[model samples]
Target: QITALDSDTNVHVYAASKWKTIELTSQMNVSTKTPYSNGIKFTWQQSYERGNQYCLAISAWRPFTSLCQARAADNYISGSTEATNHRRPAVVLMGCTDHHSYTLPERPHVIVHVAVWTRQGGPPLARAVVRPFKKPRVPRLQPGQLLTLEPSSGGRALARLRLRRGAKRLFVVAVACGANLKLQILSSDGSRVASVAGGQGALHLKLRQNQPSALKMVMTTNPPGAARTLLLAASTSAKGLPLPRLPRNTVVSTIKASCNNVTLQWKSASGNPNYCIMLQEDFNPGGHHIRALAQCDWEDVLQHPVGYLISQCNPGAMKARRQRYLVGHLLPAHAYIATILVQHPITRHVLALKPTYFKTKEDCSL
Candidate 1:
């Protein structure tokens, strides 16, 4: 019987007195200290009529490896004839006497995550992660540099290389960069599967994603730097998704900023009903900072009892400046970044402008 003991039952007291002459038998109850330094005592009181015999075994069992409870296996053994089956055999020990443990061999499981980038593809190029179940280290991406088989879910991005499903897997080609960069691929467990080579061109890495795999990209920095973007794209439909229409007559004009407050001024396009101005600071040449300081918006043609201001330039149209709003305060000396965005009043199509730049006084800076 597994009896739970409290502090009142001194471990040393029971071992010193009642259990001093324990004659263990198969019928003798075995009391353990909860496998650690428990102060509780196990009173294996022996009856004079019964002989004592006990079978005590100390063994460890792992449903999953690691405290994270995420590792499927511990190593990458060569693929055997049974690679098709996902369940990798586990190593277990029997009759363990002293603190039993098991050492997992390399490549214990056959699960892999495959990231593919396709270009006029035949067979999808593959780069198997050298180490499975670990996070991959991603290097700083140059303006035009690309990596083969990048993992991403689709979204609007400038100069982004999209991945396509090839005959066997998805494929992506990295854009070439001239300088040496370091990249590491990690699996779910904190292990490295692949590392960057010293070549200027792009290198391909493959993962087998027959099953769902969760991975993250990590990079080491020489000099301190802010967080960079990691691309993850969702599968696009068979017929290509409609591309956003190119914006025309993109203009940059001045806006007003008082302390932390900002007011933007802009002219509407022929059929523009609503507009969005995304603000991002272009102070640093190597990086772009995105943060909204304030926004001004209004609908075309008065709809409700809300006080409406008509545009002087266009009849029956609401003025742009009349819709201005003060969002929140900015830090003193911080720059105010602005962009002009316009959308078709009826079509709801968005027209993004080239990012604009400005600065706030030190009193209103963040």
Candidate 2:
């Protein structure tokens, strides 16, 4: 299940049997596991150019403190990690570059580790679900405002949130134990952006916002009895979370050049879900002049990525790739110096290894 939250997105894998998201990772459970899980291969597209590094997590959790506790847990035993009140998937997929393949990890037959590159996002900023014998006035939450909620009739609460710039998706969720409640998302203009009513119960919706927006949450419901304590929370996705970086020493194993075509090969890293290879004739390196184009400007790294030159998935890395980039005929017998950049699929960072220098033969061919 892909829950796109603004520019960020949440990739949730479910067992074929239940077909629902996990509890804590998603809040679809507290502590439960299916008897059997499907093990066929599942494939998903990871486009680094589309800001692949912009995915974060959001959830419907109580107190939001439980999430912190779950993260602070020690590496659980593969068989069953007692990290939280429940069991979690043993293997979580952080990510892999385009060069690497992502394989699900399982604990023998006991459990399947949920694939999580990293659970970086946290819950909402605050919770104001209130329950009081007497009803009181409720006001809409303002942008960038944090209001601590007190118990009152039809208790009122507000949580200010800001979406990341260039965000493409937004996820909103609100849940109250009782019925007859309303959840509304207000935009910066103070107009109602989205609301959850009509017995829809909890508010769970993924919204689309291209630019950064300020939002406030307003929840209003019937006054609760003193005995009943209201509980609810909300959160949004963000970009620039901490993520692993691609390894170094990304040398082009072999560079074979025909009069026209040039084939470059390299090995794939383990944690990388995909790879991107960029090539350019200019961008001189050092020496006399320029040697091989091994590095690019920092700003121009991820800009205008030409995509991976090639991709071949088999048992082996299949590092060897042939590029039929002939300008028509062949055999110029000229020393050509070119610069290349390999992209980290997840982070979109560029790795410029030693430049590859190849020359064409003197002979001519058609």
Candidate 3:
């Protein structure tokens, strides 16, 4: 029998003097070290019974191919299929998390899309990751620089685009060949700004920058497989050039910083009073290559839960000033970045404020 661990007494240990030498052969005395905690120690014991053997195997997967939230230990392989079924796909997402932090983790709804496909005689397609999409920080368009947009023909029933500029007028013109196409210009929070539904003819819509910094576009075509074209063109006037196109009181005016707390001050947003505060470590501002992966999230970067603090501005109303929030559980001698998410009280639209960062001193306490 095979015995391991010092406490195991399943088999008795033998001494060199107790061994019997073959008929006429001579045997030398052998001694081995006893098993201990530090290193692998083996003892030479003679027994007539054979026991089970133990072994280990190593595996290596493609970089970033491993899922962060695997429920169990199992190996999966993708075969030659153009697309995998979403209901029972090879990769399943559970949630986002930090690196095994002891604190409570935030559960963000991260939607997974795009399936990795395989071909018969061609090269394999690159894997695509699906993560929550954020609004891009686009600069204002220059004078005489016309913005043009043309949609693609695909199976998607809805498409989204964001336009960020301070300009005089924005226009969207759509030409439907024969299908019923619907166009909706929405605010950041999925609120409708301008909508048009029709059978044919050119639908022209205009928007201004002084209204909202960014807008979302949603297009739907009826009869499923009808052909359609959408053109988005924008222009700026010299009269509205000096001031930003966004409405007044749309962003936080200033941020008050302290040793262990921060106060975000802002003029009452014109339409909405609901707001949110989000904080995550911004140690690597210029390098965001790693975070582009769907698995990497605020928790992973912050080494803790995503400090997403949500609160209303005022009871029944939406106004709060000098809002002070205690920045707790921050690492000493570290830098962190914070941002604000405000929703329009009336239109139910949303907007994000400028991001700000602060550094903590040693032994910082709230």
lDDT of 1 by residue, 18-68 (tens): 233323222212222344332211222223323333211111222222211
Model 2 quality (TM-score): 0.24
- TM-score ranking, high to low: 3, 2, 1
Candidate 2 lDDT over 92-180, as tens digits, reads 32332332123223222332222222223233112221111233355433322223344345455555666656657655444343433
Candidate 1 Cα misplacement greater than 4 A, ranges: 1-249, 280-328, 364-366
**Better model by TM-score, 2 or 3?**
3
The lDDT for every candidate, in the order shown, is 0.32, 0.39, 0.39
Considering lDDT, where higher is better, how would the candidates rank from best to worst?
2, 3, 1
Candidate 3 structure quality by residue, lDDT tens digits, 98-147: 22111112211344332111111111122233333344433333332322
Residue 296 local lDDT, model 3: 11
Off by over 4 Å in 3: 1-256, 285-326, 346-349, 363-366
